[model samples]
Target: MTSITIRNVPDEVHRALRIRAAMHGRSTEAEIRGILEQAAKPEGRLKLGTLLNSIARDAGGLSDAEARRFDKLRDRAPAEPMRFE
Candidate 1:
């Protein structure tokens, strides 16, 4: 898990967070995490992978053998840095 530091929150905002956490039976940290998640990735948000899969399905999906063939052609080597003239 990654951790982040938030600095310089207003006193009123901090007090409101504590009150909201108490009301929801969550710790202040938990409440903040929930708030951040909802703000960033709310319910019913369009996801890239789902959208791509839907597009593929609409275009006549590839067979398992064809998919495997495509996968076999993928480049496994690391990308090289570009040269500057």
Candidate 2:
């Protein structure tokens, strides 16, 4: 196996990695290796169903007219106004 070195990592990012490793009950090196292995796999793209589901969720099941109405309302709504008394 080959060795690699990652240098000049930010303290906050390192701290985050430590926290994640602890959460997963893994050593920092093991946690990083697992993540890298998953990421390095060729079949790494988001699954089509997952992508479509996310899109459908964001779209809120609106019909064409409903979406158009929502866009119009969003565009015309006041950005800021007085709160209700």
- Residue 5 of model 2: what lDDT? 100
The model with the greatest lDDT is 1
lDDT of 1 by residue, 1-85 (tens): 8998999999999999999999999999999999999999899999665576567656879665765665588667767989998
lDDT of 1: 0.85
Candidate 2 local lDDT, 26-71, one digit each (tens):
9999999989988886476775545664576588875667655655
lDDT of 2: 0.78
List the pairs of residues colliding in candidate 1.
none
lDDT of every model, 2 decimals: 0.85, 0.78
**Candidate 2: regions farther than 4 A off:** 42-85
Q: Which 10 residues in a row give candidate 2 its minimum summed lDDT? A: 69-78
Stretches of model 1 off by over 4 angstroms after superposition:
57-85
Residue 32 accuracy (lDDT) in model 2: 91
Each model's TM-score, in the order given?
A: 0.60, 0.48
